[model samples]
Target: MKLDLTIPSLGPCHVDSPLKLSKQKGISTFNYSDDTQKILYDTSLKNFEACLAKGEAPLAFEKAGPREKIYFDPSKTKAAIVTCGGLCPGINNVIRGLVMGLYYRYGVNNTIGIKYGYEGFIPSFGHPFVELTPRNVADIHKSGGTILGSSRGKQNVSEVVDTLDRHNINILFAIGGDGTLRGVQAIVEEIERRGLKIAVAGIPKTIDNDINFIEKSFGFETAFTTANPIIRDAHNEAKGAYNGIAIVKLMGRDSGFIAVNAALSMPDVNFVIIPEMDFELEGENGLLAAIQRRLAKTKHALVVVAEGAGQFLFNNELGTDASGNIKYHDIGIFLKDKIVEHFKKQNMPATVKYIDPSYIIRSAPANASDSVFCGKLALNAVHGAMAGKTGFVVGRWNNQFIHLPIPVAVKERMKIDLQGELWWNVLEATGQPMEMKS
Candidate 1:
């Protein structure tokens, strides 16, 4: 197969993207198409904006003078460990490694986990924030959620820096996905402006593999493991039911990686919808028609839909839509209602159940493989922050824990290659509806 790539250059909408193909011996000539160029430019521009918005440095930008990393001698001070974002598996494991590594291994005792993410930086609600030592995190490796709670809130730069100053926090370790990193960066920028001495590092920790800044974010493998069982349970449960349809929803707020992966793993899934999958509202019967067609002689249907999929197009609970109607407490219910309506129209015997597997999968125990990867990533982030490096996120690349410059994390949307060996075959064989468009 000859591979060609297109980039927008020369003229806006006029010049075509250029491509170079690889043949047996060498590379091919440069070719261009207007459509390719336009797409290339548009994608690049959006990513560029994301980088700026996140305060992530550009991958292509060249560093000037005095741009070097700073190394902290851990023999002196303790680091801060924080977890933000929705709960994911292996979070406790990361803290376990960090606490253990800083205490017993490195002789640093003052490790504190910021409570409720950034929201718990200070004492409020009678909590006054909490602190963590190696003692508290000792048994956490086997635990599922965070020993320290997490929250979704606006960035509090000054207050966080003030807390750091009061606590004498020197090295900061932030554990979460992209949003948490943004919070970390906000604090770092404040410290820099105020001339405070501190180091910051971020651990990629989202069940959704959409953290583009890093490859193979932590908690992903475990999320996949957690997700597979739910899908399998649902898929198999379909085989034994009477005129039944089970619509299952898994978590992935803005990304569809989880949904795509789950649906592909199960061969019996009749319909799969993810944010990345192109879908539009059909007259109530369209989805029903698809389900009815996929209904086996057993009259049972299994469908896996991403929690965040089709959020903008449909209502989850009632006839009217609200602001956060984009999110649903039970996505399965939404699908089940529509499915039941379809069956009712056809006058077929029908029953529906909506399984909200959000917490079920995300709060489960860490898988062995995921724990290994999470530990390795946590260690690498510590090394990076101590090294005075800025902007890069720590993740697994090519089966190894590595540091990706913040710029890389911001600009690229990591996509699964649908034509690749394992992924391609698995998805195709199942007859799932994931569109393989770049």
Candidate 2:
């Protein structure tokens, strides 16, 4: 069980005098140089530069600065903000930033907070809209969770639209993950069908970071940072016993961004399993056998598995949530049970520590990085909506804010690129056996 000692070293990857980007006249300008811009975009750069020629180019993410654009008369606009899906860090930051952006920056004093996501619009739920002001939402960013709250259910598009029209909402900011964005899509379709003049803007809120086309969703860094301590605790617990195994399961039902990042953050992990990769349970190359091999070499071993990992071994009969997302099998508990059984069958003694810190990570407030990200996304969403841009979500494309069409955003789920640099980093960090040979 000797681990690979010759880890690949990352070479210097820096450039002098990087592209200078500036915001002017509601457009982000990248002072293009022949060398970098050509290689960066290839032929696609032509389309972007063409847009810039037409006075439309988004800010490059490398610049990472703020810009101001006034698309609507603040005095006559009414914007509504609603959050759905499960809680994640920085939800409140987005809410606060959106409120502040609309009320103060745009002079749009009439901002409404829809309680409990789209459910707030259903008449039977009795979840009415609350007026959002700078005074009321000033300190909301200091805490976690949404001040407007959230829920998950397939809402009636007609009812939701009626509610929006009844309230005379001009700009609607829907914040949630994939399912939430899908719901917004339906609402937008209804608006178009009915010939309404409402604008819909979405804030991508996938804690799992599974939504496609967005580089990195908000709260992902916060989740990874928060999970570091939890995994460290597991490592310590495993080390305390004679032959110990620590198996920690994290959120990421469809992708393994959280699990892989968490594993990279901790060096004690001996194995990292994600949903994108397949692993067995009983054979020599199986997860249990891997643990046995690691235990033979060391007194303690740490394993990290994404919730969606090893799902193929579980039963096919799955239950769907209110949003129709299938609930994943409890990989953490299942691994714990199998480990105990495997050791018992061999008459070997071992201690297994199981840790699930999902709720804690999701419930915490945004870290400093996420706070800034949420602020920028919220601000840009406001700008896009007021400019009559509908059916789009504000997302970070190559680091700059791009008003990603909701259809494009929800077209596919973003998964960890196994062959990409991030996964390579994870593999190097864990030093896990790439091919668990029998």
Return the lDDT, model 2, position 137: 89
Model 2 residue 6 CA deviation in Å: 47
Instruction: Give the candidate number with the greatest lDDT.
Output: 2
Which pairs clash inside model 1? 16-33, 70-388, 123-128, 213-409, 391-406, 392-406
What are the RMSDs of all candidates, in order? 12.0, 9.9
Clashes of 1: 6
lDDT of 2 by residue, 181-200 (tens): 99988998899889887888
TM-score of 1: 0.75
Structural similarity to truth (TM-score) of each candidate: 0.75, 0.86
Best prediction by TM-score:
2
